[model samples]
Target: MNKSPGFILTQLGLDKDKVEKLVKALDPKTLQIAITDDFGSSFVLSTLSANIASIVETNVVLQHEKDGDLGNGWLETNYAGSRAFVLRSWKPNESDVLEANLTFWRGAPSIKRVVIRHVPEPATQRLLLEKGDVDMARNLSADQIAGLAGNKDTVVESSPKAEVYYDGLNQKHERLRNPKVRQALRWLVDYQGTTESFLEGRFKVHQAFWPSGFAGSSTETPFRLDVAKAKALLAEASYPNGFEVSLDASNFYPSIDVAQSVQATMAQSGIEVNIVPGEQKQVITKYRVRNHPMVFLYRSADYLDPHSNADTFTRNPDNSDKAKSRPLAWRNGREIPQFTEKTDAAARERDPAKRLQMYLELQKIVQENSPFVIVFQVQDQPARRANVKGFVTGPFADQIFYLLVQKRGSRDRGLAQPGSPILAGPDPGIRAVACDAPRASDPRHPRAHFLRAARGRLRDRPGGTDRPRPRDRG
Candidate 1:
């Protein structure tokens, strides 16, 4: 089975026979895999590592289950996984309902039901959140976020997303092909000014491809708005008069604003920039084909690994238009052989500390030289009613989990009162079992007591009381 051409061994560039011999099924619940190559650690962090790591949920079906392009309809008709919630109903462009998974392995979710409504208008979303008709409002503009400041009933939660916004200078353009010109464009970006104004609270100045808060991320901001320096570099690149170029940007907030800012700054150094704004899809379609001279865009990592961003931003194995592997570097027509070699080596490094150091060095090299001018990392700000608690939004939007989320009031009142059940529903029988299990102060809380006992801090006395055990002073 491992030797079959359809197997993933070919994709990983591994010897199928070796891998097959190293993997064995010991029992129904136990499978062992031995890694013989340095690529093992990095591969484990990727989405292709395991079924659970895949972006799509892993489902158990008959040997020969559904076939032929299911496309987007797969999730609509099928149910899978042992998640806290199960899809109850879905209506295209309208709303979706998620019912609590009563038989979930962990426990039934606190919320009995979750209804997600599609309200595209930010104003409408704000109104619904303020009126207590909705528990949370996800898509809101900078102005809308500020407007909700005085709403005591609603509180905004902010989290730093792993998405980074940047300007990709296409090497296909003759003028942009110069390394000095590319470096000069970096200085033209007013990172401080942009983040301070329209992009305030929404984005932070992040110069590196790998976003901050990651293990090997670099928070270095070397380039600023230096017009004289940019002009000198343009002169060195044999473009003393500064050449004219077209920039493709999405006709929406932030992208258009950033493009206009770039345009204004580039003009200071005698560069003429013509802004061509189009719909998001149209702009991205052009960008993907390397048809744009320059593009203003944002990218989020596919997985939580330093190699994720490094591979996309630095490694371009093939610069040809027909290249099978097209990452961000390929799309920008950048042929970075040195960066590619370093990125691959970093991914394969066995030691955690050494791998992290390699990534930090790679980020510095890309930050100073690459055609991509990484500007800001996005901050997701979602407003929710005060009654809603334990709502978690991870670095990625898809990482949002509602397992522990709870409403602290009666269903009809929409107001939280002290001593109310964590979640309220019409059927009191379906109340959260975990909530009624134990209090933190109760001696019977097994988890708390076990944790303390594990640290040798707590011991049971003869009278059934927990007392702190004496430390071993010796």
Candidate 2:
């Protein structure tokens, strides 16, 4: 039973001798991980700790109760995964940016001194990038992207994301427990109208939890606003007069707007929705641990695989007390034993073709019964200063390949000639690249030179050749 020394050492605060002895004495059941989506790729899924997994899988409340204050917090970094950057300090900075200083190790990029300034507000981020303060602005709204068009000093790049924003109904609630009532609610939502009008064509309507283009994605809008059908289902569920329920959501822009839209549309079918607004964290706490009657939240895959999502919504335990993760359907006491069996079997399947079929089958089964009102898949939009060369972002927010980004002439090329593209490249045009390895560096001479290069030359000089960066690099 090989265990991760890094994880164990940090968690227990024990000496090597004591830790090894404790690990050897533990029972096998106490060290088992419920889900292991370790399919070989750049991405893989597995619990950081076997001991913690055994507890949290059975009691979801334990995770939420701690929420990072306790040692068992889900996101508490045990140790650095890669030695490319040793996180020295992280704290809230001016203008709402979360500043994190990363000390360089060997095999790191040439521009080694790195400080990740995380700016959450898109508008503030855009202003900073344009004024030559910050070099990059991420997840720009469609409006911001439109505003940057034809600007010689900046470039807008985008990629399809694996994230989904959906509405979850708690089956534990009397009115929501009935399958027909659940189905009735799905039909009452105007998924198409919300995505098209409110989202401004930035999102794609999804039929299930999985996003489109994935192996199991249905990409089918099975439910639509049909007042008559919704009414009939409510009648069947003994809710002819419809019922009143509270929906909790964050003040975040599109989410609050979506909840309000659902509130208005559901009223047509006699379902009265009371929209409760709160901060994002407060809303999340209410929905996940308290099991709010209705919740509008977003979920994104940790890895680019169908099992990453399917297994979570399906493998719910019959005894809710033993449920490892809170499945949307289980919140309302809805049961589909077959759904659990099928999804678990599929997750364990080795053959690619067979796995794909299993995921598709799972989607169909969930859509026909579950308490999930699947909404839309979002797209990522990031804008960078034209001078910032080689920056790339992937489908997920954390999929940043910052090591490849190099400033022009950081190593060899001289100041680009007048009118030449200032790194808005179809290519960042360089002859040879450095090795991709991280080694220990002298702390005193930490390459602080990179920061100066990052803010240089916003526009092309005379005789400059402009080449736009490829959209597919990330």
Candidate that scores best on lDDT? 1
RMSD of 2: 11.3
Q: Model 1: C-alpha RMSD to truth? A: 12.7
Cα lDDT tens digits, model 1, 334-424, are: 9989889998888788787888889899889889888899999998887888888887867764566778988875442112111111111
- TM-score of decoy 1: 0.78
The alpha-carbon lDDT assigned to residue 358 of candidate 1 equals 90
- What are the candidates' C-alpha RMSDs? 12.7, 11.3
Best by TM-score: 1
Q: Ten-residue segment with the worst summed lDDT in candidate 2? A: 413-422
In terms of TM-score, how similar is model 2 to the real structure? 0.67
Over 82-111, each residue of candidate 2 has an lDDT whose tens digit, in order, gives 333333233323111111113433445644
**Each model's backbone clash number:** 0, 23
User: What ranges in model 2 sit over 4 Å off?
Assistant: 1-89, 93-115, 118-120, 150-152, 235-241, 321-325, 387-389, 406-474
